[model samples]
Target: MPDLAYYASLPRTRGAAAALLLDDLGRVLLVKPTYKQGWFLPGGVIEAGESPLTACVRECQEELGLTPRLTGLVCVDWAPPRDGVDAVNVFVFGGSITAAEIAAVRLPPEELSDHVMAAPEKVPELAPAHIARRMGPSLRGLAEGRALYLEDGRETPFG
Candidate 1:
């Protein structure tokens, strides 16, 4: 087995930034990628040397054509490794958009096929299992005013 030191020295996992965006009606916004079957939150892979926060903001603008000002980080999920891919570090941030902002949103044709504003209670059902697990807890963390750590989308220690 590899030593702790060896593990510590391993390559850092790739990461992505996700935004939990809410509207005046308190509905959460989720996006459907043109390339995928399921809906997802506003997010994308973090580019080299870019901060997670910056990535979230950039992705929102790219995906939804809105300049989101994220309030704070709500969750940091260390997604389980899969299919030769290293574990993904997912960062979820809290944000909101005004009615005008919502009206101004222009979905990027190449990235998204559709976008929905689901009621808070319906978000879990709209997303996949992994996304649901993290989003549920992350929204709670946003409501309670704290950050939540997660592993495979489940709440983790040092939260």
Candidate 2:
């Protein structure tokens, strides 16, 4: 068995969780982070001792100011390391937002800059490449009541 120091020295991948929220018009909700260049799903990095689902719910409440009841897993994407950044495993959950909930959204200016309800087709234009690539499969998975496993945002034969 590995010693505690050995285990602690092992490489660890980052984990993040996001919500795939939709409105009555079937438009997806996207948020622009003040720290990033492109739009992204409503979520953030998973904290210590936090499950993916719990992180998703907590992030949604913190970012959108609404505690939505997330339904099911939509996608689990493994983004390979790039530009010296550690690899990240992203878990996405599906949920719907009512008009009232949408109206109640309040972004913390220090974190998020803006939010938009964009048609599914427009997601690719607004989000980062990885996020855009993951959107279609995620949506399909949601509609089929199944979850997708993706590598670098593309579905693979094996997880």
Candidate 3:
């Protein structure tokens, strides 16, 4: 077994979960957070001992005030450390919401300012570069009906 010091020396990565929710017209649902500069998906950091999917569902409920029936894992992206932040492993899940659900969305004024259903191409304009980069692989995963693994939001050739 490894020593405690050896274990402590290993690099630590944070886990975050986000859902790629789409409307009937296939527009992506994006949220504008009051606390952040750019728009983001309806999800947040994983809590202690919580699974990524659990965090995704919980965030959706908290952010949008409704429980979403997530289709499945779309892509898992390993984001490199940047902007003085630690590395993060982001799990993106895919789901579709109805018009009723859209009507039911209630954003907490302190956490979020607004929400919009944007075409996929507009994602780059709304979100940060890192987040925008993930959309391609995530959408491809949803379309292909398979999960994908990515690094810095780009799919790798090797398994």
Candidate 4:
């Protein structure tokens, strides 16, 4: 009755943005959420009216207490629907942290209970499979200076 057809025609999807924050030592930043099980990147769900890149920076500040100087796109993943949930579009951006930025870390206690700076090789063991797959390639792409289009975590020709 109230434009139900219009709503039905719209794509049902969610979006999130994450920062691939690397230190001078080439370690990646990981945050432990009190509400979640495994370690994840310094990022969260993108809010409506917010651009993906901007959401990445915002989440970093909210979670880590430092305004990361985000640079290039790392990888964009199109994750299919799971458990009847809408599909998700995840964007990861590469950002390097200065010593000053590291010094400014003041994690929000209520959200994050712990943090880790892990070597590249250890990211897979640190995060869940979906994230692990993405992080490895993201770190590589950051170093190789290229961005990738991915489905879930694997780089595929089709998105």
Query: lDDT of all predictions, in order shown?
Result: 0.86, 0.92, 0.91, 0.86
Instruction: Report the C-alpha lDDT of model 4 over 61-128, residue by residue, as the tens digit.
Output: 89988888877888898878775867899999998987677767888998999888889889888887
Q: Which stretches of candidate 1 lie over 4 Å from their true place?
A: 1-9
Better of 3 and 4 by TM-score: 3
Best of the candidates, TM-score: 2
How do the residues 1-159 of candidate 3 rate in per-residue lDDT, one tens digit apiece? 769998989976799999999899989999999987998889999998899999999999999999988899999999999989888899999999998899889998999999999999999999999899999889889887778999998889841
Clash count, one per candidate:
0, 0, 0, 0
Give candidate 4's root-mean-square deviation (CA, Å): 2.8
Q: What are the per-residue Cα lDDT tens digits for candidate 2 across 1-159?
A: 659998899987799999999888989999999987999999989999999999999999999998976789988999998779789999999989988888899999999999999999999999989899999999998788889999999989953
What candidate 4 gets wrong by more than 4 Å, as runs, is 1-8, 83-85
Question: Tens digits of per-residue lDDT for model 1 on 17-134?
Answer: 9999888788888998988667789999999999999999999989888889778999899988775877899999997878787778899888898888888778677777788878
What are the models' TM-scores? 0.88, 0.94, 0.92, 0.88
lDDT of 1: 0.86
Model 2 worst lDDT run, 10 consecutive residues = 150-159
Model 2 pairs whose backbones collide: none
Residue 56 local lDDT, model 1: 95
Candidate 4 clash figure, as a count: 0
